[model samples]
Target: MRHHIVHAGWLTAALAVLGGVFALYVHPDFLVTLVDQIWSCF
Candidate 1:
């Protein structure tokens, strides 16, 4: 049980990273806009 839970956690994190990479590849400008908005908030 614990082993499966650990594997699931890693899998989730890996998926999240892959999703982010896909987003970056598909929308490089999105991160730039996001950072601009975040900096404006400060």
Candidate 2:
């Protein structure tokens, strides 16, 4: 169970970083707001 949880956390972090990179490439201006929204989820 604990291993699964850690795996999920790492997966989520990786996806978030990918998302940030994509956002930066497509919409640099909104990256901050996009990240702010992501942080709000936490």
Give per-residue lDDT, candidate 2, residue 28: 67
Per-candidate Cα RMSD to the true structure, in Å, reads 1.8, 7.3
List of clashing residue pairs for candidate 1: none
Compute the lDDT of residue 10 as modeled in candidate 2: 100
**Where is the poorest 10-residue window by lDDT in model 1?**
23-32
Cα lDDT tens digits for candidate 1, 1-42: 999999999999999999989988799799899889999998
Task: After superposing candidate 2 on the true structure, give the runs of residues whose Cα lies further than 4 Å from its correct spot.
Answer: 28-42
lDDT of 2: 0.90
> Model 2 reaches what TM-score against the true structure?
0.63
lDDT of each: 0.94, 0.90
Residue-level lDDT of model 2, residues 1-42, one tens digit each, is 999999999999999999888868897668778788999999
